[model samples]
Target: MDEDNIQDDIRIYTERRWLRFSSGSYFPVYVLLAASYLLILIYFTIGLFKVFPCGPDTRQWEYFYGKCYYFSLETASWMQAKARCEEKLSQLVVINNTAEQNFIQTRTRNDRYWMGLTDRDREGTWRWVDGSDYNTGFMHWKPGEPNNDGHGEDCAHVWGNGEWNDVYCTYFCYYICEKPLPIRIKGHHNRALSVP
Candidate 1:
């Protein structure tokens, strides 16, 4: 064959080979790529639905029972302790039940720690710092304690033995602060969470 005819034949053969190779081979590759993207999307969607658990974000605080507790390393008066807790957006630990009292006792290391209860306002009607009625909840007073000895004791503190005692609010003692965990709702729309 002549040179022109040979060149034309080569071109036609190359086109035919290219078409045959691409016609069926690309479908599987496309499907695989599409599937990979779909899997990635599914992974993120499921992750979004997962309710990231809430807990304390600061190393100085401890997370427990949907609340954050901070045991102050320094001693302060009852009023000072309350101010410090307020600075951290928390309040003195409030014991609501036996289990909670036990939990605080374990952390006390047999040392006194100021609690949230106090009868400062009315002497007999104790109240929490949050303004909750103390008479309505659990109490752990020491035997024959809270006698208001000499009628001076007013603020409440947890004894080394985990029993409650009313002492002078000005007495310096380490205190425990408590902050409730932010409420978390489980649903598609409420997926975003703020933990502290």
Candidate 2:
């Protein structure tokens, strides 16, 4: 009985030693394969997120659809600023999303700026001078901001923190504008439409 037990123990020890030696040879290969897979995954993920080629940096401007969108500027009164923007081959700039509002607010060194929004035509119905509805995507107002100081305050101002607060229409501040890119439709049949 003792001899048989000794032989069993020896056999188990030999098997374990062989397994360790063989597995050691393959361990490095397994590690290398896993590392290579990880590297490939990282490369593809970064490439997928890379931005497409655009034009030169316009600072606080976005060049899209053959138009230059400008932000972070100063002007006096919503009415006067709208007139000024119109004169610049543009209109009062609209903040379409939070990304745009954040971009404008970050670029601005001033305390405030005028946006193309107001309740001038109606008391509570805010509208952009471009005749667009006030879609509340990027709008961040201080608590109770549009309490419209009686009837005199119809215009809107963008604060340093990018919040819209209703101020007197005649108040002065910087403003943003959007200039449509002059379209020179080449190829007689293809007309390039200036859109967002």
C-alpha lDDT score of every prediction, in listed order = 0.82, 0.70
Q: For model 2, how does the per-residue alpha-carbon lDDT over 91-191 read when each residue is reduced to its tens digit?
A: 88777776766776776554778878888777888888777667654577778989987757898878857777899988888887776553434563223
> Which runs in model 1 stand beyond 4 Å of their true positions?
1-56, 183-196
Predicted structure with the largest lDDT when compared to the true one: 1
Task: Give the C-alpha miss distance for residue 154 in model 2, angstroms.
Answer: 0.3
Q: How do all models score by TM-score?
A: 0.66, 0.57
- The candidate 2 region of ten consecutive residues with least summed lDDT is 49-58
TM-score of 2: 0.57
